[model samples]
Target: MTRKTVRIAMNGVTGRMGHRQHLVRSILALREQGGLELADGTRLWPEPVLVGRREPALRELAGRYGLERWSTDLDAVLADPATDIYFDAQVTSAREEALRKAVAAGKHVYAEKPSATSFEAALGLARLARDAGVKHGVVQDKLFLPGLRKLSRLIDSGFFGQILSVRGEFGYWVFEGDWQEAQRPSWNYRTADGGGIVVDMFPHWEYVLHELFGRVRSVQALAVTHIPQRWDERGKPYDATADDAAYGIFELDGGAVAQINSSWTVRVHRDELVEFQVDGTHGSAVAGLRTCRLQHRSGTPKPVWNPDLPVTHSFRDQWQEVPDNEEFDNGFKTQWELFLRHVYEDGPYRWDLLAGARGVQLAELGLRSSAEGRRVDVPEIAL
Candidate 1:
């Protein structure tokens, strides 16, 4: 079998999501599995070159993985002709410039979203990648979750006859760092550092809604800083400038209304930290990260409304669990494999930089709606 080695310059792997998901679970796991085999039997092997600002962390991580390549200088890494892909999971404030340099170097670019701090910059990156004729993509990992995948299958099978509305609850309490250490980085709470629930999560909601239900027509949102004061990683008190919570009402095409709440301050009361309930004429479904439960019109429970009476039926027991028809792998790994195919074998890849820009656009509009106290129309984005 023919073997092709592709070197990936991975930035920000020292960060939580970057290290755990992108590096360990996705790329490294793929590497351990003897790389990805193409349609014609050619194996595509990924060699990850760690890139970050910290020397010690890079050295330690590279050494831990038994990998030889690691670098603190991003420019030198990008300039290497051997670097076939540039993957960025850096902070939002620093992503745009690094992405620009990578695109200019003619490397295939993939990055975590919000790809940039604003819609303009995200669109610029998309256009730049297009003009450079490079294969580019953004991480839309949530769409590959088992629950969402089952939900997609249900939609394809006409389970939801004329979808009406969707309700999504996402978030768990993030420690303020005063009592317990904060779960997320301190920068995530500062506005100047491109941190906010609206900017961080609206991009996720955009792609999920657009892919499953419909394109968002408009949005009305209210953003708030629930915890104004929080301690940093260094145990230093600072004023939290970014919005920790955002409540949004999104109007999707085909008359589906979606209400989603994103927060870093809310306590989780559901089975999963995040879950979406999609309602339709024929049936309804509630999907979390790993499970999806469906309630058909035939199995629907009816109850008469009474002011003072005992509940008649077990409402929670009514829905049936959707069976997993196929084996599911790590979502990040799955996407990484697909991206490799797209780059080398010319496979279909829709989640390009433009898609990333659309996410950023929704985020920008969501923030605008919150500020203006009015519903904002979502303009169609084009390359």
Candidate 2:
């Protein structure tokens, strides 16, 4: 088998998600696993060059990982003819400019969601990549997750006879950075810094619903900052301008209604931090991050609606668990492999920049709906 090496310039890896998920678990893990095998019996190896703002962090990460390449100069990295791919995990505000430069540099581009701060910019990036003829993709990691994959299999097997509605709950309380330091960065709560539950999570919701259930036709959302004040990294209080919580109702193309609540203020009460309950004509399924349980029409218990009396049926116990027949890989890593295949052998990759633009569009429309206090229709986009 011929060995093919592709150099990847990874940006903004100092951030938590960038560091852990993309750089460590996805890219480096693939390297440690002897690279990815392509369809043509070629072992496609990844050579990652760390690129970021801080030189100290980049050098430290590279040294810790035994990587030789680490650079604070994005322009120099992009100018290198050896760089085959440019991956961005930067903040929403910084993403567009960097991506534009990457596309201009004639490099394959892959990045995290909400491609840009606004729908227009995101769409612009899609157009740019399309016109530039570079193999582009977005990190739609949720679709590759174990629970969602099982749920998708159920959909494929016609387990849900006629899909009716979906209910999603996602959130966990983030500390105010006072006594307990904030788990999330302070920029997440500031609107100027491209922060908000709507902008951050609506993109994920868009792709998940579009891929698994149906395309979102319209959205109505109530976005608000539940906590007005929060301490920054330095333990200084700042007015949290971004919306901490968002309650959204989405209408899908196939007549399915999806209601999702995303927040950073609410405490988790479910099996996972994020969970989706999908109901259909024949059955209903609840899928979390790693588990899926379903109850068919025949197995579903009929309960008496007596408010004054105690509930008799074991509702939670009624659902049957979906067993994992196959081992599940890390979602981010799985996507990375697929993207690599797409770049090398011209493999089928549907999650392009346009899909990412759709996600950003949903987020933009969601925020608009909240501000106008009305449902906003999602318009189709074209280059």
Query: In model 1, what lDDT does residue 41 have?
Result: 100
What are the runs in model 2 whose C-alpha is more than 4 Å off? Answer: none
User: What are the root-mean-square deviations of the candidates from the true structure over C-alphas?
Assistant: 0.7, 0.8
TM-score of every candidate: 0.99, 0.99
The sequence of per-residue lDDT tens digits that candidate 1 reaches over residues 45-110 is 999999999999999999899999999999999999999999999999999999999999999999
CA lDDT, candidate 1, residue 35: 90
The positional error of residue 105 in candidate 1, measured at the CA in angstroms, is 0.4
- Candidate 1 residues lying further than 4 Å off, grouped into runs, are none
TM-score of 1: 0.99
